[model samples]
Target: MKTINFTQMKDGTKEEYDFLAEMEKPYLSLTVDRVLTELKNQGEDSLSGYKITRLEHGLQSATRAYRDGADIDWVVGTLLHDVGDGLAPQNHDRFSAEVIRPFVRQEVAWVVEHHGIFQMYFYGHHYGWDKNAREEFKDHPCYQSCADFCERWDQSSFDPEYDFETLDFFTPMVRDVFSRKAYDPKVIKENQVFGLPEPIFHKLS
Candidate 1:
């Protein structure tokens, strides 16, 4: 069938649902391309008043992580860490973390999620905020990693003179990372993956 007949999901037959599911898988597989495009557009809206554009900063962070011998996941995480800046600036850290959570290790997600709070150490005091705000999480297992990310990648990535790699240099790596089974059963339970098209049901119900 060209399209399902039901306007509402409650009227959908099992075969119709399965057909829709099969059709969706290919679009779902394009998540990586969509994410990379979003990252590429990071500098178009606002430069955030930094010396370098968001795209440059992201590339610089990833370049440093790769040069420092980080694994593929770490490099990708650093590269797209500011991706959330495009849509959600205040909670960009969490947004970024959620975007990569399905494809990366839990540790990488943790670092991405908390890097914003950790980054406050660099200039929070300048803005009348607490520079030591990150200290509250000093005992967390990923605390040091987040702090190191802020120090070595996130915070220090604003230098315009840095010899950073281009977004093209990291495109293959992004695809590799995103190609992994999303929300792996070993890391996240199979049931928790929301394994089917809930949106169609919920929205059309």
Candidate 2:
């Protein structure tokens, strides 16, 4: 069956739905490729006025996570945390979270989803917004995790001079991540809060 025979979802037959699901497998298998392409596009076009490109920022974040001995999920999550900015600037954090939710741990997704609010602690006061806005999530299991993510990886990644890894260096890691079984309970580890690894300090010359 090349296509479904129904004009509307309400009229689709079981056989047709099954066929569609089977057809989706090939597209699903290439998810990592699409993600990588989008990340490269971010290097070409992203929000202006930053010291580095959006792709550079993500690479720096992931480089930091990997150098700190974070697991693959943490490193990839940091790499793609801002991916949705090009298409969903208004709430890119949540959008980016959804992009990785099926593959990474729940704790990582939670941090990505809420990092926007948590990040306000750095510059919101300059605009008269409540810098403490993230305090509302203080009772949640991943609150501190999100706070630490913003402080270490997200907010601190804008320096153009930082020696970040190239996209090629992280492509294999990205493939390893998105290739996982989607939403596997063992992979998600719901509500688990293995917070960010301690920074790996490098002495200045």
The candidate that wins on lDDT is: 2
Report clash pairs, candidate 1: none
Q: How far is candidate 1 from the true structure (C-alpha RMSD, Å)?
A: 11.2
Q: What lDDT would each prediction earn against the true structure?
A: 0.82, 0.93
In the range 60-126, model 2's lDDT, one tens digit per residue, is 9998888888999999999999999888999999999999999999999999999999999999999
lDDT of 1 at 192: 26
RMSD of each: 11.2, 1.1
Worst 10 residues of 2 by lDDT: 196-205
TM-score, every prediction? 0.86, 0.97
Error of 2 at 52 (Å): 0.4
TM-score, prediction 1:
0.86
**Residue 57 alpha-carbon offset, candidate 1, angstroms:** 0.2
Positional deviation of residue 118's Cα in model 2 after best superposition, in angstroms = 0.3
